[model samples]
Structures are given as structure tokens and as C-alpha cells.
Target: MNSEKQKLSVLIITLNEEQHIKSLLDDIDFADEIIVVDSCSTDKTVSIVESFKNVKLIRHRFVDYTSQRNFALDQAKNSWILFIDADERLTPELKSEIVTAINSENVASAYFIYRIFMFKNSRLKFSGWQTDKIFRLFDKSKCRYNEERTVHEKLIVNGPIASLKHKIIHFSYSSYEDYKSKMYHYGILKANEKLAKGIKPSFLLQLLHPLYTLLYQFIIRFGFLDGRKGVIICYLNAYSVYIRYKELRTITSSKI
Candidate 1:
């Protein structure tokens, strides 16, 4: 009867995430190895990471989310990998569950972890964030991020998948301005991804898609149930869609 615990490696990709790095590092201290692939952040992020003797920091050039994550995957030495974001925190229940799952004899290739989205101090219950989940923990040898996606990267798991009970606390936005900037950045990345896949943008798409998104999120998804926060989130979601098409049009038009 062999009884050896599985070694876990934690990977985090960061860029000027000084505010969340330290706390996140503290939370994931149980890992056998911790790797932080930074995009040359011009902040105290690197220094804060350096304070953790257990963390291995690698500065890589920013290409896209998928590439950055894949780069981090290559750097991991352990069989089990937990890819966590700087702004996300794993609760004690989730951490314990992860430890138990990896140590079990019949472990899945990957696990889907749900997230509780937070806007500053408030936790938004709606705004299309009710069913947010991500593949964060998995076997390093069996999973890799999809190269095609640049913004919202998806994992390509080779084997069986399972879902965890507890959820990760995602402190998504620090401020309104910060959230808007991130949405715009994500919109640009998504537009580039669509362009790569030979997808063209239309004026009607730029106009109507945003309206549809606003209605779908605010009304259909019950975003309005959350009140003021819901309104802001739904509007931003619509704005992101508008920016995506608007950017796609700009890029295509420039080539002509």
C-alpha cells in the first residue's frame, strides 16, 4: 500500500499586480513549487514576489493570455498544477478539497472551480456571473491552455474532468475605472482573436450586439436584481461587446 501525497505546483501570470500578489502567495503556500511568470511589470509586483523564497519568478514578454499560461505550464515541475490568478483567492474549504482530491487514488485529469465575483467590497450575485467557473487545477501532463483564445483562455484537457464544491473568491475589479480599462483590454484581445480566425465585423453587429448583450445580462440574466452594481456590470459587458466589434472594424478597415 503506497501512500504518497501528490506534489502540486502553483502557477500565476502577473503584470503590475502588486496589490494582490502578496496575499495570493500567502494563500497558496501549500504547493510544492510556485511559479510566477511576469510580463515585466513596472511595479512592486516583482519585489513582492521576490520576498517569497519559495516562489520562482520568470519574466516573459506579453503575447496573449493563452501563451502566457502555456509558458507557465512549461515551467512547472510538479505533476499537479493549480493555475491561479493574482486577484483570485482560494478559500480554506476549496484548498482542503484540492489537497484531498490530488492525494486520492482516483483523481480526475482536471477540476473546474467556480468563482464568486466581487466588485470592490460588494459581491455581485447576478450580472451573468452566477455560473462563472474555470479549469484551474489539473495534471500538468494532461492539460494545456487553448492557443486560439487570447482573452478568455480555455483549457484543453486530455482526460476526465471533475468539478469542485467550494468556489474561489475572485476580486474582479478594484474600481469602476479599473474594471472599464480591463473590459476594453479584453475587448481588444477578443477582436484580435476573431480577426485571426478570419471573422469579419459588420456595422450592424457593432450596433445591435451591444444592445442584445445589455438586455440579455440585465433582464434575462436577472442582473437588475443586484440593483446599482448590476446596472454598471451589464453596461460594461455591453460596452465590451461594442468595443470588440468596433476594434475589429478598425483593424480590417486599416488594411484596405
Candidate 2:
């Protein structure tokens, strides 16, 4: 079958992301089906999603990313699913590649797309983010999320995977405050995940991890190449690690 003849579903999960919702939805109009699984957004997000045609909106309670995405995958009608975040936009080349890839014979169970991270509207080429990639596009039957995870969940692919050349743009940090707020909360989530798994807190992770993260990103990863933006990102990354362990300490303490 030709690329245009093959159908695919695009799935996205959103909360109160009114400021960051429309761009991603507008970019993936090429998909045969666009499904938005929202966790009860009390903002203009729902209205904006309602404006798009060929888009089906679903309201589900907020769970971890893995379970929520898996639920969204189940709601998808097509054999192929493209999972995207609210801050992510599909480039034209990637959209074309995805359409072509889905229709190809002997295709693998999934595909990996490299991500370009944008911080405060500036694209950061260094800061150890250049290697960022995710396996998001896949055949629904052969792939599902690892629901046991509480954060940074990995997809489970039952078969071989392929790769695409073009990149997906991730406007992950709209502002410095936004980045800090999100990362701190992410720290809490990660800490809780570790605690639930019976992983005890460690002084090495709590005390040394943050410093190691800073040096690794700034020096080893050549984060200085991005100049001021790189320095900012590097510091924030280290801070996030610090917060994670600190939160873990608190969780462990509360239990005792």
C-alpha cells in the first residue's frame, strides 16, 4: 500500500497546557486520526482541541505517563500509533517520514526519532541534549508502555525497531520558572517511584549526584558550546538530580 493509503493514529496527553497545546496539534494534521487524551484540563486546552477536525478528544483521570499513554493507545483506532507530548511539534520531514514508514512492508515494530530541545525559546545544540531521542512511533500491537514506571517510562517493543532521520522539536521549557517548577515536581515523582521499589536513599546519590551531573554536562558533554543557555541548562539538570534525592530522603523518613 502507498503511504497515503495506510492509516495511523496520533495520541497526546495534556493537562492544563493551554499556552502550549495548539502548536503540536496543528502540526500533525497529516495523521489519519488525532486523539487527545486529556486529564481534565480546566483551561482553554479543551476548547482548542475541539477546534480541530478529525481529532477525537478523550477525558481520563491523570495517571503516570506510562499508564495514561497506554490507555490512549488502546483508544486509538489505527494499527500504528504516534505518541507526542503537548510541547512537542512534528517537523514536516518527520511527518512525511512517519507516513511513509507506516506503509512500508517488512517494517519493524517501532521507530526512533531524535529530539531537539528548546529552552526558553532558544534551541540548545549542546548541554548533553543532542543525543536525546525517543521510540514513540510504533505498531500498537507490538508495543506498549512499561506501566510499572512512575516517570521517564520506556516503551516495550516486542520486535525490532527502525530509525528516522528528521527530528522532532521539543519546546520543553518555555521559561526559566516553568523549567524549575516542572523539574522540581519531576524530582518528587522520581523519588516516590524509587521509594515504592524499596530502594533505600543513599548519601552518594543525595550529595554527590548533583555535582557529578553539573560537571558531566558542562565539561564532558561540551555544554559550554551553547554558551549562556548551555550553562543554565547544565545547572538546572544538576539541581533536578539534587532535588530528586532530597525528596527521596523525605519520603523514607516519613515512612519511619
Candidate 3:
């Protein structure tokens, strides 16, 4: 298939993402079309997108990450879709890779890209974090986000997957406060998911899991190489687990 005829589209789901959308838009403007599915942003998110003629905006209520993403996919008018988060930007190399993939004859229906996670001014490359890949680019017709009741949603694909060369830049945490707050929010969602499915963890399991998580991410994942930032991420992940299990116990005990 010819590259120009493929009609590549970029789909993004936003909610008060004004601070991050500018960079995302700048990087992905190379797409044939841009679709923004917003859950009613109270900030200037809509206005900023309004400045771009290539961007099409759709408003919908918040359900979950998967639902919002799938809704965006349903509205896209392209055969090829690149799903990007508001905080994520496609690096120049990644954009070039996507173009090459779209123009190729035997490319996979879905492709994974490495992610470079940044926090504050530091990019943590180690402490057990390396070669982290996400299935972001997909053929819209044969792929969609699974409507899973989880915070980190993944795409469901029907064809072979490929890997991209450049990394997707993820501004995961701008501040320490933001990181802690997000962990709390994600912990709530995880605990609720566990509680809904009748999955129970023993007290010992809860106590040991957080430590194991910290060690795994820091030692095994090599997050330690990220310096102070790596240590912070490892600690936050461990704390997130502790909070999640604590929430789970509370919810379960209430039901009993």
C-alpha cells in the first residue's frame, strides 16, 4: 500500500491536559488527521486544540481510560491510527519510523515503541527500567483498547505486532506531589478492581509484595541507574502497592 493513500491518524484522549497537549500536538502533526476525544476539560485544552485545523475534537463523559480510548478509535476516519496520551510525545525518530512503517508493504497491524519516562528534569534510564515497549500504533480496523477495568489499558490486536526504533517520550511526573497523588488515584482503581473480582491477598502477601515490588523495580529493572530519580520512582511504586493492599483490606472488611 502507498504511504500517502494509507491516511495515518493520531488519536488522543484528554482530560484537563492543557499543560502537555502542546508538545504532543507539535510532534504528531505529521499525521494525516488528528482526533482529540476529551472528557470535558475545564481548562484551555479545547481552546488549544481549536487552534489546529487538522485536529477534530469530540466531547464525551469519563468512564475509564479504555472506554475513552475506544471511543476515540471509533471516531477516527483512518485505516492507520497512532494512539498517544496527552503527556506523551512522538520523538522525531519515532515519527519517521511510523511513516516508514505506514509506507511498508508487509508491516504489522500493531507496533510497540520504547518509552522514555521523565520526571522533573531527569530522565531515568535505569533502576530496572529498560526496553519498556507499548503497542501504540495500530490498524484502526483490527484494533481497539480493551475495555478492561484498569488504570493502564492496552490495545487488543488481531494481527502480528512489530517494534519501532525511536522511543515515545512520557512526562510521567512533573512534581513529587503529582507522583504521590497519582499513586493514590491509581491505588484506588487497582484496589477496586481486585475487590470486584473477589481476588484476595493474605496479610503476609501484602506486607511482602511492596518490598518485592521496590526491589524488583530498583534492582531487577535497573531503576537504580536513574540516580536519585530512580530511587524516588522505586519508593513510590512500593508505596503504591502498600496503599492498594490497604485499601483492598478496608473494602473487603467492610463487606464482611
Candidate with best TM-score: 1
- Give each model a TM-score: 0.98, 0.95, 0.92
Lowest summed lDDT window (length 10), candidate 2: 1-10
Note the residue pairs that clash in candidate 2.
none
Error of 1 at 236 (Å): 0.7
Show model 1 residue runs off by greater than 4 Å: none
Q: How many angstroms is residue 118 displaced in model 3 relative to the true structure, after the best TM-score fit?
A: 1.5
Off by over 4 Å in 2: 1-4
| Cα lDDT for residue 11, candidate 3 | 90
Given candidate 3, what's the lDDT at residue 170?
A: 85
lDDT string for model 2 (1-256, tens) is: 3445668889899998898788787788788889999999999999999998778999999767777888999998888988889998887888889878887876888999999999867789988998998988999899888866877878899998889999989999788888888888778878887877888999887889899999999999989999989888898888888898999888788989
- Relative to the true structure, candidate 1 reaches a TM of 0.98
lDDT of 3 by residue, 76-189 (tens): 888888888888877677888898887788889899988988776667787555777888888978887766566778788898888988898888889888889888877877
**Winner by lDDT between candidate 2 and candidate 1:** 1
Whole-model Cα lDDT of every candidate shown, in order: 0.93, 0.87, 0.84
- Candidate 3 global lDDT: 0.84
Deviation from native of the Cα of residue 192 in model 2, angstroms: 1.3
